[model samples]
Target: MDADLVECRACPRLVAWREKVAIEKRASFANDRYWGRPVPGFGPADASLLIVGLAPAAHGANRTGRMFTGDRSGDFLYAALHAVGLANQPTATRIDDGLELRGTRITSPVHCAPPANKPTTEERDNCRHWLDTELELLKPTLRSVIVLGGFGWQALLPVLAGAGWMIPRPRPKFGHGAHVRLTGTTTIDLYGCFHVSQQNTFTGRLTPLMLESVLASAGRTAGLLP
Candidate 1:
């Protein structure tokens, strides 16, 4: 999928709101042009473990054109991935920072930057097709997925369920190390740490150790590490 297409401003409401944010925050990101548009998936194209996040932060991935880059969330996420040996670096401050993934891929359910971090159901539904396509193109090798939150799990579950797999009842609720195995081949492990926003990290809601532990468990489950 082309990054530019994902960054599209087809939705009038989203376009207007994004433009406003760009105008208001012009000085901070003066050289940091807002992707002010949809963000595309990034990471190893042939990864086996897929990590799904909620959506792009207006000034974060939505601006940097890389999943989880340019934000506190990416900071925490990349640190964990690096700690687990799935990433080559410990920090991601820009889209072109040359960071690389070894065994994992990160993406969001909603490709576009939604206003206020909330995407309408219709918008989410529309984006699911892209998600489905991406999954299909990834092709038959994914062994596990790590969904970051309840909303992400909800968006992705139906697709997995439709593929002749059984999802757990009470739905395998989200929490650190929460996992569900489907069809004896693919496993969906959900780790529900608070999103690594400035609010959460600054408040100490999710510490580095906590996030690293989750990634460690995910690595073991996915057989990416011992």
Candidate 2:
């Protein structure tokens, strides 16, 4: 499934943009080879906790080929995860940077980096099936999910409902530290956190302590911590 997901080009606009940025190359990453294809979720298959972000960064994951890698957003996220005992290390500069998630996984609704970090509704819908399939495969062991930002929160609710969980009508609102109970064959808890984007982090909107608190709470909820 991962092999097939990597070759996806279903969204023309996303395809063009990801590939274009790859070839042009950022000045800082000119010597680095870009993983311009759809970046797959990273972490163990049986992860009990999942972190869903909006999408890969144009020059970040699109360049390093790993979710949240080579970007300030990733720097903020990994450090928090490490602090909360959910990651082996805090640095995520590259795919081979030796960073490891513990009983947790990171993924995005739209795998490809969208232009200007925004994916059209159509593009977001086009990429739904990948996440749909991923949820089914992870359902057995998955216990909690932390959705970052409104885009990811909006995108994930329906997918969770379709994957056999009961999402209440009017839907759950998205807010930092918001949480909801999702009932299915197995109960799963869903959490909302502000995206660890540079805009949020640098502005003091989402601080290190804020992120670590959420992670630690989610990890304990998922039974990943005592």
Candidate 3:
């Protein structure tokens, strides 16, 4: 599954931007090779907890080929996962960093990194196929989800509905700590969290304790922790 995702070139703009960043390498990582491809969701296929983010970071995941790797955003996320006993380590530096997640998986709505960290609506829609397939495969064990921002929250609604989860007519609004459970052939409880971006963490818009609380709640909801 990951093999196919890495080879995707469906979005011309993303294809160009990702490759450009790989070649123009960030000064700090000038000596390193960049993955410069779509990053697949990371964790066991039967994970009970799924985390969805907006997209890869131009110099972060785009460089390491792993979601949130080599970036401050990953630092904030993995640390919280570790505190909840969902991650083996509080660091996600590279694909082979020896860090691992248990009972939880991390993915993005947009696989490829976008210019200025924003993927246009078309790019997001074009990328939905990957996420749709992923959710279908994870349906059996996926019991809870944590959307990392408004973008992910919005992107996941229709995907969940399409996948057989009944969505509310008015739709739930996105807010930190917001949670709703959908019932259909399968039930999945969704929780919202502020993105672990520097803009949120550094500004105290999202604090360590706050993020941990939501993760802990999801962990309990998924029966990953007591």
TM-score of each: 0.88, 0.99, 0.99
- What does the lDDT come to for candidate 1? 0.74
Which 10 consecutive positions of candidate 1 have the poorest summed lDDT? 184-193
lDDT of 2 by residue, 50-126 (tens): 99999999999999999999999999999899988899998999998888899999999999999999999999999
Q: How well is each residue in 1-226 modelled by candidate 3, as lDDT tens digits?
A: 7889999999999999999999999999999899999889999999999999999998899999899999999998999899889999999999899998999999999999999989999999999999999999999999999999999999999999989999998999999999999898778899999999999999999999999999999998898999
Q: Could you give me the TM-score of model 2 versus the true structure?
A: 0.99
Q: Which ranking of candidates, highest lDDT first?
A: 2, 3, 1
lDDT of 1 by residue, 1-226 (tens): 7554565655676677766766565467877677666777777777777888888887887677778888778888899889889899999988778898877888878876678788888778777877787776554667667777767878888766665457777676666556677763354444555566666678887788877877777777667888
Lowest lDDT sum, 10 consecutive residues, model 3, at: 181-190
lDDT of 2: 0.94
lDDT of 3: 0.93
Provide backbone clash counts, one per model.
1, 0, 0
